[model samples]
Target: MQRPAYGQSPPLHHPVPQHVSTVPQLRSPPPPIPQQQHQQQAHGYDGSPYQQQPMGAGPSHNVFGQYGNFMNDPAAQLASQFSQTAFKQGTQYLEQNVNRYVNVSALKHYFNVTNSYVINKLFLVIFPWRHKPWSRKQTVGPNGQEGWYLPPRDDINSPDMYIPVMSLVTYILLSTLIAGLRGQFQPELLGYTASKALGVVVLELVGLKLGCYFLSISNESQLLDLVAYSGYKFVGVIGTISLAEIVNKGKGTGGWFGWSVFLYMFLANSLFLMRSLKYVLLPDNHGDARGPMQTGDTRAKRNQRTQFLFIYSYVVQFAFMWFLSRP
Candidate 1:
């Protein structure tokens, strides 16, 4: 055969060298660049594999579907399962033990600030109002003339009347006694209130104990229950007595009023016990007036009736409050 011209390609009809055909077989489409490679190339380079995929497949499909399979691989699945298990366990532990994290010492501080706190400094200023004469005396003058006058014994400032020590002590004693006495009677509603009051005390104690054990707080005072229960009685009795007076004034009679007073008095007392907080809060505006019973004044005698009226009014108010505080 004649030699080919210099630099001329071989004839198209001529058979190609076996090596050229073998080279194409060796290339073999490169096993379609593994999914990971496509992912890397799609993200790492300017061109996107999403653009090359079928039109029906969205961009998210190309990015996630290709890689999501590996994320769900056996080893990855096991790691994910372990992570979920640990997370659930941690959450459950926190839920079951969160009470331990509560700061119950704060509750004690709140209680001290709210109940039985003797702020004598502020009280010293307010106590004077109790001494001011609530009522004045009047009598017929000589020669059939009417005259208004102060009582012969007008000592409006009496330490004993305003101090409230006796009232507090008496209230506490009477409350305990009445609660004990009445508890045996098993009156339907009154007994219910008493039982619930006991339950509240128990729950408070339980909370206190748990708080102490887990949170390192302490609540060792037994008087807390006493004061709490006493407060209830104080309010309940005061309210009941007041309501009885109002009822007696309007629609009630002797025996009816007396029994009504007895029945409602427990409600008033319960209110007092429930709202022990009232002992601590007071008005800031108090003038330096004379005491409840001043030196040598019979105003106390005339005003004693008024005081009794006030006591009864307070009883009615206390009963209402107790009813509201239930549950």
Candidate 2:
């Protein structure tokens, strides 16, 4: 190569060569510097302004707190800690079934009917009937000696016996008619004493009778009128039992107590009234099944004998009624 003059430019030409040698040159690219590829993880976006810290390590973000200092405080854990979130969760849970509907009007009517029946029964329990006094007499014989015949004590003061006995009889007849009308003839269903069923009938009848009498709506008692009201109580009890059984986790034991003890009051009172009936209604009816009357026989046979005595005793009742009707 020769340097060109300052004033003249060199001519661009290739020189003719007799022989040529070629050499390969090696130049490596700068060792690729590992350019870190920033990636987004589940915790946060790659370009997020705020940094994420390990959970429970630093001050926790208290969703519900007066000051950030109380954020990580375990003692501050409360329902309000995530109240809005919890409320949202709860709202979503409830909203999932918001379309569900219940028969509220029917339930309300049913409760009304039950309360009405209870009120009527209370009236029957409190109302005073004519009190009959037992009469004793001393007979004077030819020798001027007085022989005394002891009089039995009447049960005017016993509310338990009186209320239950009257209620039972009234209910039996009332429910029999209701069941008969509903095209049911299974007397066995009637054979079992269900206080609530019986209460329904008796209270309904009493309510209808009293309402009609008081309001001067009608003097006569129709079978349908009693059945209609009793049906209400019956339906009410069924509804209550159904709701408690279905909606509550508690077992049916509590329901049984409610049915047996409070609503029915049948078992305890039945024993009492059954005992009183023998002594009060059938004195001569000496059936072990009978109250004070003593007899040796099976329960069924005793009941049969006692029924006959009861029929006989009713003659005395009619006579007493007739005497009372006298001026």
Candidate 3:
């Protein structure tokens, strides 16, 4: 070791290190663990630890953080579920049954129906004789439902609901106009006309259903088919009424114009129904011509059935519509 300089700090002396003894004090054993804890360890838990997931907060975009708890009500959740279920059920029911008697989609198949076609169909209703026979233009869809590929030009069996629906509205409006022109218009009259038209439709539908049952045509399930058939009279009625409206404006006719139109429409409607409803009412190729096994009793019965249906569909329906359409 070198000696310190005169002006520098002197070197410090180091004390010898002494070992301090960690006294081996007697240690007390940890207090005995509770029996309850031991039991818990042995049995895991009394009930399921993960009973259910915590409900998450629903999305509330741009909402203040304080109001983030909205839409979390249990009753609201239950009501939402109920409404969703009810809506689903109601729509499903309507979808299936709405088209049972009238398929609106079938009427508006753009390729099959047009303005020109709609106008042309009026003549078909007036002159059903021009249509020779029911054409076999049925096509089976992917869902196994059969439908027309294109409506037959003049056949009564051509189920064109568009004509009936359109002509019905037209007929109502025309009748209303005629009534208004004569100062006979009433708010209730509109209701009367609409109700009358609808009543006739329902009545006709029921009548056809019954007719098919009594006749046992085996085609009664074609209820909408018959509905379309029955609606044809509206066309002739509408046409006749329109013609009468023009003729009555001559000032001397009093109201003969309306009466004259009613009579002519009656005749025209009868003819149309007679021709169109025959296939349903009358079986073509009567007698032994149809089959060798055909019995005389069966033939006679069919003839009688045909006669009954001819009158029931033509005369009876014409009377009903004629009476109802009176302003």
Candidate 4:
């Protein structure tokens, strides 16, 4: 090595270059992140041990495959068993008790009705259009189709026992809410609610049964028929009380809503009874079915009697409801 000038740096020495290795490096590529890991990161969830394995494996390879079946699901098994047991019990109870009381054919027929028919009747009870096709006829066929021989009218027999019961329950619930709003809630009222409503139902059934007996129609009617028919006023009662609740709700009494619904209830109930009771009240003339046709005079008389009976029945029902539904 020669010495450079005073300002110049010393010469650099290059080391011998290392020989290039002919063999490739054995290091593996970093494993790609799994889709599950990405999902867990995005959702901020710890990847569960249950979901660690890839899906759609053969039964032989999958350890959790048997658990995939519905029978192996704890929650699904519990719900299915509970529902089945409840349904079986309910069906048994209905068959034992309710079936013996009511006409089975009639009950099944009523149950077969569509939701549209019931909803339409509910709407029409307010509007009551009196036109062709829409107009309700009070007359039954000469063969007394109103009897068990034919199905009851859709508009007349809609909802049956279910509506009455559900409406009464809803009424009690709403009344409880109203009472709570007024700071008058009492758990004791719940007991009285069931008893009083049930008492009213029993009273109405007895009253209607007595009336039918007096009218000589008891032979043709079952006790549960009166029960069903009498319970129908609860529908109007529920509607009226609901309107009153929406209006009164801790305030003063319903101003327009109360009176308006009351009036409508009266009219609707009367009209409903008119259509529903016509068959029972005014059966076709016995002679017309076999011998000669009924005279117009007799027909008119029956119609008049039916009209009077309807007015009397609905007015009585309205009065009973007025007293029963008072808050």
After TM-score superposition, the amount by which residue 233's alpha carbon in candidate 2 deviates from its true location, in angstroms, is 2.8
Task: Sort by TM-score, best first.
Answer: 4, 3, 1, 2
User: What tens-digit string does per-residue lDDT give for candidate 4 at 130-204?
Assistant: 612422233465775642332334544433555555667876787777777788989988777767788888877
Tell me the tens digit of each residue's lDDT in model 3 across 1-327: 898788999878898657546546689876456965775445454336764423332233336443444557677778889999999999989988987965657545422455666666676666555666643244655687554344544332455667888888887887788888888788887777888988888887787777766765544325555667777778767766677557867232237677776666677667666665554555444421212222343776687777776776567866786665554
In every candidate, how many clashes are there?
42, 0, 0, 0
How high is the CA lDDT of each candidate model? 0.40, 0.38, 0.63, 0.62
Q: Rank the candidates by lDDT, best first.
A: 3, 4, 1, 2
Candidate 3 weakest lDDT stretch, 10 residues: 286-295
List model 1 lDDT by residue over 187-263, tens digit each. 35455655554554455445434432442222232233233333334333443434544565533223565566655
Model 4 segments more than 4 A misplaced: 1-99, 102-105, 129-159, 219-222, 252-257, 286-311
The RMSD (Cα, Å) of candidate 3 is 14.8
* lDDT agreement of model 2 with the native: 0.38
TM-score of 2: 0.19
Q: Which pairs clash inside model 3?
A: none
Top TM-score prediction, candidate number: 4
Candidate maximizing lDDT: 3
